[model samples]
Target: MALCEAEKTFVLHGVEENFRIDGREREDYRPMELETDIVSHAFGSARLRLANTDVLVAVKIEVDTPFPERPFEGKLEFFVDCSANATPDFEGRGGEGVAIEISNTLSAAYSSPNVFDLKKLCILKGKKCWKVYVDILLLECGGNLFDAVSLAVKAALWNTQVPLVKQIDIDGNNVEIKVSEELYDCRKLDVEKAPILVTVCKIGEHCIVDPNVAEEQCSVGSVVVAVSEDKFSTILQTGTGSLHMSTLVDCLQLGIKVAQRLDAALWDTLTLECYTCSTTEDESDTTCLDNPSGVVGGVTDCDKKYCIIVRVDYKDPRGKLASILRSCVDKPTYTNDVIEDETHRVYYRSCRTAKCNGGSGRSDSTSDDNGSLGDKSTIYCPGIGDGAVAVTVSFSILLFAYAFVRYVR
Candidate 1:
């Protein structure tokens, strides 16, 4: 959208005064919501919503031949798709231009070996390697796409579980690979040094970090800096405006600082004590998600503490066990079965086991199945602590002005 002269002046004046039209200072980011593990079958996935811009990222890994030139390294490919619902310009191939640009920028951002180690994806040097595909879907755009997409991509990669190669057979020119049948036996991608992109828009005489569509229209040009640790991975300039070398230096410094803070916050979010099952309903899904088949489901970290599940049991007449899954429960309830009405001899067991809520409320379960609920609470177990540690742990969910998001991947 084009901004009229009057609207442009308003944004320009705000930047000059160090206040944006949204009332944020030049350095402050819009409050964000991030959720990971949304794709039930994908190795890893995450969705990010920054005010208005929304992006979904999923990572899938496959065994393939390594590049002949870079035999020791694996391949990582990025693809971006813009949804027609995002905007009219994104309808059909209209959004292809934007998608290509974003994906290309991401490829460049992670292209550096130091930023994301491709060697880790290598399974057997020259013969076999893990090719990772990161698919990004743009659900909406409200400006600052570079930053939003980068964060979402990082989250997805951080949660990605690279399959464990159990066996490899080499017969002359033929190679056969076998992966562990255990679903959780995969290794997480080390995204500790993943690049974080921050877009600093040059509006008037000042620079802004998180610009809205209106502010984007008022800008002369923008610089996107992808920061990894204290260094830069890639730098890009957008818009038709020119910037002085000195101003560009300032943008780089600002981007690095913000990227570092964002990185720390994201790490804290992932390591915090929060977990959930891939399924949101029934006792079968409640079993810590360890069992992808049979009596179990899959497990992952909630954006908060414990994922919400409609734990059901034959004992409970209604079978709607109160659960707050994936919203990041403050603490996982190991065993908290409270009796609603003692007159009926009804015993609603909040199993001491983390995953045994019975697909709940069904009259079919014979209590014998109840014994297996919490046996392996160790499955994907992350944070467990006494009351004191939980106090500090509760605050981890709110870091970065973040709101919790829930998805199954």
Candidate 2:
């Protein structure tokens, strides 16, 4: 579908005015829908819909030998499949090129040790480890596919529950291992440093994030940046046009800023509490979202403000002490009225639990109970980012965020 000269001019004018065709700002993303644990057979799974683009990711684990050179580390593999249902052009082997590109991008993003700690998956020092297979299915291609796929992968990894190994026995060259039979006794992957991909498209003179298919087609050039922590793990350029060094730098900075906000929003969605609402038959018959307390299905109030603060104290064996404190608050609030609802899960393990404050205004502090800290070790579980919760309203459904934590020496 090609845009006419008038349509392209209109889009350029819209960008110049800082308003997009969908009325979104330069950095704004389309309404998104995310759901986790959808695949029962897979170890972990999540499905995400960003407007017309749809993505599904599943995680599978297998026992295998570790790499000879890096025996202590496990393996992570990514596989992408572009379904023909999305478009006839993707039928048979037509989509293979796109699938390979997406998969390679994912592999590059997760290639760094700081991004994902593979050592945690090691079952034995040199003999055995867990192989993680992340399979992605692309049901639709609206645009900004890279960003949508990365988000889905992160959500699926967050939902993954790796079984705990109870013990290991060795007889001759044979190695025997025992895994916990209890379903609840499992550990979660530490994805705090997992990378998120952001695609920044350069329009006439402006760089925009989350470009729709039409916007993508009109762009001169684009860059896909993989962000983890406060740095870029991988940066790949797409499209044919080239950018000046200054323009490239600006795009990198913009990508970082956009990725930070996106990361925060994702964490907020994953940590939001279940919002309960009541509705009558009449209310259901009419528009439920219009009423303040009615229903909106997955749409939520992005205007609602919230804040969260977390403090963690770590004491090493040498008596060195370190404290990590983080906090974030919704300052002015977003102008968007409706957003997709997303559910998140958390697990906590600690000797002394800290009380949390709620709502728009909150002031809380961590307990100074160092009495139990002298003789025993303590593990404190922290939320993904600043731990802020998103405000939500939905129709006819109640959802709760679950947290599970395990203690180990």
TM-score of each: 0.69, 0.68
Native-to-model Cα distance after best TM-score fit, residue 326 in candidate 1, in Å: 21
Off by over 4 Å in 2: 272-409
Question: Number of the top candidate by TM-score?
Answer: 1
Candidate 1 per-residue lDDT over residues 156-216, each given as its tens digit = 8987888888999899988888999985567778887899888988888887787899998
Q: Where does model 1 exceed 4 Å of error?
A: 273-409
Error of 2 at 11 (Å): 1.9
Residue by residue across 1-409, what tens digits does model 2's lDDT show? 6898888888877887889998877877787887776788888788888888899999999998999999999999999999998767799999998889889998999989999999999999888899999999999999888999998898788768899999999888889889999875777787767888999999998999899988887889999999997899899999889998888998999898777667656654543322222223233342221232233342332211222222122223322112111122222122112112222111111111111221111112322223331111111112223443333433222211111111220
Worst 10 residues of 2 by lDDT: 400-409
Q: Each candidate: what lDDT?
A: 0.68, 0.66
